[model samples]
Target: MKLIIQIPALNEQETIAEVIEALPRKVPGFTSIEVLVIDDGSTDDTVDIARRAGADHILRMGCNMGLARAFSAGMEEALALGADVIVNTDADHQYCADDIPALVRPIRDGEAKIVVGARPIRDNESFSPTKKLLQWFGSWVVRKCSGTDIPDAPSGFRAYSRDAAARMCVVNTYTYTIETLIQAGRKRIPMTWVPVRVNRVERPSRLFRGMGEYIRRSVATILRVFVMYAPLRFFASLAALCALPGIVGIVRFLGFYLSGDGSGHIQSLVLSSGLMAMAMVLMAVGILGDMIAANRSLLEDIRARDLLGATTRRRHDATILKLADAS
Candidate 1:
């Protein structure tokens, strides 16, 4: 199998070389391996460093286009080069290269379409406490939503078969990792995880800088993933949460009135009425959002089907033409 190892980097000149050097030179199943470094508009000598490290291909962006776009570009290139599998790794030398073979093995064996390198955060003290907390919460949320137990839903180090990679259309730039896992689950792609060792990086993470920001972004990503895949569940949960207080208030108020205790509870009445109204409004909005999500999902399915059919037709036509020429 032809494999492409993609390293998306921005201003990682200091650690990129070490990261490249750490990658294993040979794997058992891969017939050809190419290293592709995507320089996402770094003012530093990241491109030069990547070239010096013997990267087979380099994609340079004119300006910092963000991680998601850089990864998309790199995946497109890998696909164009007819890569059967693509492995994504960080440029900060945090991930262990020795674990790459294990990560790709499941895909090669046709057991999984995606394999994630689950880094044990306990080994590194460099990760902020808040970041760790957010990761835990995010993983829990993903597990609950996707019905899949993932140890590291936000890990950037992962391998995807060409089929899985082709299906991804990432919309979020910063939180693409979370979206990727969620989308893969939605696509019914078999996913497996392998434990990978991680070390302290030379440069700190650019994404999770502060505790509050990290938490906020992670929560937002979780909500976004829920909306993307299961909009009905997301909205239904929101509606239920909003209706709980109102339902409780009404039950208590009615019980008191029926027992001839109190009918002049204006506060309770107002609170219940307001809450019920809010709940109804939320439910209405949820219904609309669910409809939109359904339409979007249908469109995406149709597009994927069309693409697959076109590819199959072209392959058949080419084969027939080759047979005619041979005859």
Candidate 2:
């Protein structure tokens, strides 16, 4: 099987070469392995360093297209080249290349369509408190959205089969690890996680900058995933959050009115009514979104079926051609 290793790099001039060089040259079940470096408009010499490190293919973006777009482009290219499986790793050298085999083994064994490298956070490793909280919250949100128990849903190091790669529709450019998992879960693709040790990188992480940014990005990712995969749950949760306060207010107003206290009845009634109205509106929107998600899923299913049929036909044709040549 053809296996392609894709690394998405953005201004990783200092450590890109080492990361590429560290990849294993050979592995079981893979007849050939190709290393692809996606340069996301790095101003530094990232492209040159990757070329020197013996990359089989280099995809250069004209400007900084962000991680999601770069990754999508790389996966598309690999799929077009007939890669049976693709592995994604960061160019910052945070993930160990030695763990690639472990990451891909489950997929090769037919146990999973996607496998994620879960990073171990050691006691000695220090991260900001806010960053830690965001990570925890993000994992929880992903679990809720995907209905899958993911220990480390935001891990960037992952392996995907051709089916999973082709089926994913990533909207977020900054972060897509969690979103991809949610999408896979929605598509009924089997996924597994393998624990891997995280190595310290030479460059600072973009995710470790500040608490506010981390929280904002994490929330955005969660919401995006919710919309993409489980719009019903997303909208229902919002409606419930909005309507809960109104429900309580209405109950309190009724209690007061029944208790012969009519002084603040008008104000309470107005507030409760307004809250109920907003909740209803949100619920309607959520229902509409759920319908849209259903339609989208049906379309995706048809597309996937057509693609698989085409692939099977091509393989059969190739076999026939080989037999004719032999005769």
Best by lDDT: 1
Tell me the tens digit of each residue's lDDT in model 2 across 78-120. 7766688999999888888998889999999999999988876
Query: For residues 22-67, what per-residue lDDT tens digits would candidate 1 score against the true structure?
Result: 8887888999989999989999999998999989999987898888
Candidate 1 root-mean-square deviation in Å: 3.3
Residue 135, candidate 1: C-alpha displacement in angstroms: 3.5
Deviation in angstroms for 311 in model 2? Answer: 6.2
Candidate 1: worst-modelled 10 consecutive residues by lDDT: 303-312
Q: What lDDT score is found at residue 67 in candidate 2?
A: 85
TM-score of 1: 0.85
TM-score leader: 2
What residue runs in model 1 are displaced by over 4 Å at the alpha carbon?
128-134, 251-263, 302-327
Q: Spell out the clash pairs found in candidate 1.
A: none
State the displacement of the C-alpha of residue 159, model 1, in Å, after optimal TM-score superposition. 0.4
Q: Rate the local accuracy (lDDT) of all candidates.
A: 0.83, 0.82
